[model samples]
Target: MLAAGGLGTPAQAAPTVTPAAVASHQSPSAPQDLAPTPPMGFNNWNSTHCRAEFNESMVKGVADVFVERGLKDAGYEYVNLDDCWALPQRDENGKLVPDPKRFPNGIKAVADYVHSKGLKFGIYTSAGTKTCSDIGFPGALGHEYSDARQFADWGVDYLKYDNCNNQGVDAKKRYTTMRDALKATGRPMVYSICEWGENKPWTWAGGLGHLWRTTGDISDNWNSMSSIMKANLELAPYAHPGGWNDPDMLEVGNGGMTDTEYRTHFSMWSVMAAPLLIGVDLRTAPESAFDILTNREVIAVDQDPLGKQGEVVSSEGGRWVVSKEMADGSRAVALFNEGSRAQRIETTAKAVGLPQARGYTMRDLWKHSDTNTAGTIAATVPAHGTLLVRVHADRNWAQYPPALDVRAQDTVTQAGHIAPVTSEVTDLGGNAARSVSAVLTGPEGWRITPKSATSVRALQPGGTLATDWHVEVPTGTAAGDHVVQLTAKQRTRSGTWLTSTVPVTVRVGVPLPPGESALSDAEPLGSANGWGPIERDRSVGEAGSGDGRPITIGGDRFAKGLGVHAASSVEYYLGGACTTVTAQVGVDDETVDKGSVTFEIWADGTRAAATGTLTQTDPARAVSADVSGADVVRLVVTDAGDGIDYDHADWADLRVTCG
Candidate 1:
């Protein structure tokens, strides 16, 4: 997935790759000692992007930042250079050389300078004849042995071998040649395979290199980071102590994402044991990014001797919980909120492979505090935010009983209207609970699902039973908050019954003031077109293909509102009392850092509020339209650019002003 701009020359179309060919070049066993844990270092891609800007002085400057910025003390070591760092051709003796202009003093001097700082030096080359950004560089296709000898002679300690003009050779064969060549160099350089996961490297990369790319190059945006993170989770089982997964470089200081998103990115990467190759301009990174990149406590979890990759133990309602077993028997966990609004994520110690006793002594990694781990640990995570913690065993009897998670809207419409309710019951105990059931109790006039006992045959530990309920606020219900309770009961294999109760407060909202309600709370007209169910307070999931999800939440512009993808046209009724419409519109927050979505509000077929064109990174803005004499107002989000590659448009606080 290298962008056209990333390639110095047009990529030749190659036929489909075969598994046999990929396997032919793979080694029986890659040196397990090369990367005992994920490599921590900085690379020169996100900052320089393979341009001629990479020179000996630049590498030296990065090395200096490594020490001055406290990175060296935080376990960061190697300082590597990516594409565009070599000469157009080799020397008379067929030795690849650095560009004389950029590295007039040569790479040996740069390696010496890096080593002088008590750090390691890394260089980049390609499997093809020409590098991805060969601008003035030749790749290491046929000259692997010679180039390896030269790199070893230059005192290089790490090598990032990429895929570029590879002359149609099999991926395994091309990469194998370099790996064997490096082994022959007699230098202990860390070998990183940069095949970009084209041939399912996770399947056969065990002994090919210390680490291999799990996906194409990552960008400094939310969608790109999120997709890559999810993909990495699937390949978790294939990772080991020596052969770790490399999800490209770090983008913590990259400006495309907000502080919260960056933390989510870094936290996920750390939990999964992905190599943390810093990809930002370390010299001028902001304090927040600097703190995030240099957090030693977080780094300890990654460098733990157990070397186990993290897994997603809990996933529901746009939230995911990941857990990694540490060497000391403690567990490191991270909760992520992928939804647009503030979401609540909960999990029990027993559910994440932790033995349940009374509870656990948990230390919040981000909050940097000791907190409660009693019954269930729950955190209200902001959109794209993460809550990470390290949990130590307290009562280690290995008991995880049935844990229940229930959430409903804080407020519901007047009587006779139904609101959404989601309930999840899990058996966190070590054994399955037979005849599991849930019951609800509430005030008069409110109707709940099943209205009777809902029976589940059995609830196994780590298994969850999900139920969607609707609470109808009877026609004459009071406009105030009322407490409703849901109780879960289960019997263990020994026939002992245990029950847990969760109480929720649901408020009945008063009728809308004369003019109207927000589009999220308003019903879509029959004349409108809707994609899936009109979302409220949550962003839509990406479509996976085609134009991708129509909307990016655009950074949670408002606390409450509808979420939907674009090319969407929907109208809300306001009656004759509405005077004006005001709403904030932006590309949703989940965009892929490209393309644009158009937002428009039509008043009787006349354009009123609109955002001409907004790229993925654009923030949400207020758009006001005059609906003073209108009966129905329309909201239309369209693909504005070449295509809606990443346009997740959200119109928040879409309310009509009445006088």
Candidate 2:
């Protein structure tokens, strides 16, 4: 139901009712009468310009026509005068005044005129330095408060705050600033924030304003209307009462769109819970335009107070079907054929979350009629046309049997003494390969190698493999689990070799020993060295300084290229004598593995204290490890023996804390 205009405060009491009170009072559960549903109104900007050159005769002429055409009686109450109705400048006290030439009798007289006709008056302004029409005083930045108060004084019921030149500042803050200012005026003016959805205003603007523009400026054309509707459908979840998602103003009654397209536009907007601000020349609209605009069934969904916007469930070609869950446990569906040829669209209740149902009532909003149906329903929609239906099931409905569901399979993992490896190759071939030789087109260090020949190939639980390759896990390679891949070349008849590979998971036993340590205490100087100084290739032997002993690890020793090289340790002698220990190390790119590293420790030089290793089968990755123990500890960079480059390794601050 729509609201009638009145000046009573929100908290004011109704006139005393005698023993015969036939009218229903406001519900106690629903406080603060919401602005009203189905905002039926006509806006001037789209059809006629209200410039300074136009006079009072023009304004009265439009108002008289609105009443004569039964628009006001049909519930289109607000005769909103958009931009350019106001002068280009403010008065001495910086207050906006209506254009004297356009509004000769003053804004107060115009307001009285509109009120006498039992209609509300709406005005437009900018949230920026200039209005879109390039007229009227700017009300953005610091002038929101002053302009809001002035608008309230002029008896304005609604404010359309446009985003013109108001850039740089955060949009939320700017819109909220004006909202708070408007609230302070002791007037309940509906705040419309026009930001064009930059940063998705619907996500946050609901709490700040009554409505927000969800798309770019809409033109009076079918293409513009359809594009705006499509964008709004994707953002339907944000519409609700006290706030709405605006797809610009109404263009149905305008001449640019055909009758078929206009029907689709109205149905789509209703399902989207978009504002129905009529932007046509209402006084001179044809009968068909009125019929399209006054479709009762479509308006029911738009005015459903539940305020939920419908969403598109599927689309084939240009024919699309959208559904919205109504507050009454019913579903509102729209079948739209946007293509050049008519199409038949069908939807089952089960597909729309409604299972088997009996005695279903389908209401055709445009035809203002209801049809009974059972189970699935189909309709033939003309090109650029729509068929909107609201479906309700009887209480004795049953659910349908479920359909078969398919699940994805998992890949197997390999086992061995080889180091655990994980690789992530970007911008490589579209597929993954197992053989080092297959991916070794550029260099040898780019592939993964197993510790031995006995390792069996096992696929990962997930992920598609790029190639097929051989697997070999050698005995006594290592004492722990390892992952390896082999690439094999399949020669074509033309002698062109293509590579295929598979990953092999191997589990072994002998874990390698931790590396040796040489340097001493490595500490930051000057208040914990918040930003330490450790120049490349530099070394220091001090317990408290940020610099530590610099040890260089060589890569030319290991068969795969290089293995773990340097380590640092602190000793706790008998009789409670504790000396601080620290170390720093550098790598010549060849000494470190780009993939993984491990850290370990040995107490009193023999018994193992802690142990761990890291491996990267892919050369373009890095991993870190932390090791700590009582007497001694070691850090190892495994897969270091693998033919990979570790050119980016710098270890610092290896220390021991004693109890």
Candidate 3:
């Protein structure tokens, strides 16, 4: 249950049951009754990071703006002071004190000023020995209870706990310690965990805190803000009432972000159900910032009682379509354009599992108007802008049946032709190569080549076979499916041949909207050969002339000149605990490979732990392995290889999963 704060006088604490107690008792198991929606607030981190010159006057100034501009009435209740608020040293009792220069009136005075404006107050601290502000304030450390009491005494309504300078200890324990301590304080304060992806707090922090930072710190620039927003879309499934996945603080209203970017930022956050912690200097924000922040339709999504964050359903170029399930069974859709040019983003109600109902209510979140019709919604979003629309069934609407197309591509080829089998063609494991002969027939002028053919022993009656022939399909092929035929021939007794045929189909790849790549382009860690040169397409590399160390790609190279193979092969490592070896390979620019490519690490050249595969079916992908075990260790990349250019690889992301 949401804990209660403050003490009632003896006269008010009589045996009479209050309305709040009666309502609470009526709902015994509702999660919303316990946690409800997240508290809306404004934080000072993104725009002003511990400006040493800031004082209580500055705090009061920002608070005054919140009140005068109706931000507090709009549900922004907390004025959070982030980092560098404490003195350089704690008192002998291990209690942190506000900095005398910046907070001369003490924390209580600042809290009082905020309270007078009908807003709550928040403070920041670290789970480690030192805060990010570099101040030597006492942390939760071994004094979780003491620190909790101190914060309570200071009337802090919320606490932002940072995870910096605190390592070697289990991260969750550190967070839980503070949570328990705060619970014991008899003072209800919101807990915000600031652990940046170390242990994805979004998956488990719901029981321990009010919110958790899901991404790294956001800057005031559009690139950083948009990138962080894009990453947070994948984490939407975890956001809910009482707990939220924070994408740092808002960069909107900050001077650096463009007006269009600011609108997109606000629209995206609302769709994601992310906390609306405005980080701008409110006292000086332009009118546009206020309009973007206070859009009722957009704010409705963020403040939706259902509290479901939006997820990216489809994205191309700079256009992205995201959807969030609302409490009323309606879906909140956000069409975002992050490109330099305006583009039309469209989505059918069926695509989002919605009823194709005519005359449905489509309220524009930013414009605060209802759209006329809604079977299929399309909007020309401005560059770096967004359109948020809440789709709901109206009594005057007509519903239609849903239509969906489901099909999978069945053919694979290289350089626009059926590649022949060759003696050098091997599986991803570097095992013995496999050889086969195939014949392909299609429209006139179409070309066919063998990729792994061992020998040209026989051919069909009317087919032409060439070892050096490679087909090149023109760019921008028409959208739709096209078919061709492939016939395989095997040499038999008396110079005769056996032939078999298979059908192949090709579909034109869709281009991204403007500034984005398809999902097929995302690369994960620990992929084999993820760090090789762009020209070498082969999976495993050939051992160098000397020393013959196993070729490694992803991890930090210890023995400077060691070379990883171009084909695929497992490598063993031996050395210091800090030393590591990695292997990675890139996929072709087109085509996505399915299934995980697992890497097993062996200590002393023996099995240590069986790690799961780094799975991907995305185009332009890379995976790697990190070897840091003691003595000797072996790293293996599993699964069969696919696609062309496994020979002439490209440079991609190379990072160690674990070290």
Give TM per candidate.
Answer: 0.63, 0.54, 0.58
Worst 10 residues of 2 by lDDT: 401-410
Instruction: Please give the distance, in angstroms, between residue 333's alpha carbon in candidate 1 and its true position after superposition.
Output: 0.9
TM-score of 3: 0.58
Deviating ranges (above 4 Å) for candidate 2: 1-38, 49-70, 134-137, 395-659
Measured on C-alpha atoms, candidate 2 has an lDDT of 0.53
lDDT of candidate 2 over 183-287, digit per residue (tens): 889887777778877657766777777777876677677645775677677666566666777878888777887888888888888888877777776557788
Best by TM-score: 1
lDDT of 1 at 252: 91
Give the backbone clash total of model 3: 54
lDDT of each: 0.72, 0.53, 0.58
Q: Would you list the rank order by lDDT, best first?
A: 1, 3, 2
What is the full ranking by TM-score, best candidate first?
A: 1, 3, 2
Better candidate by lDDT, 2 or 3: 3
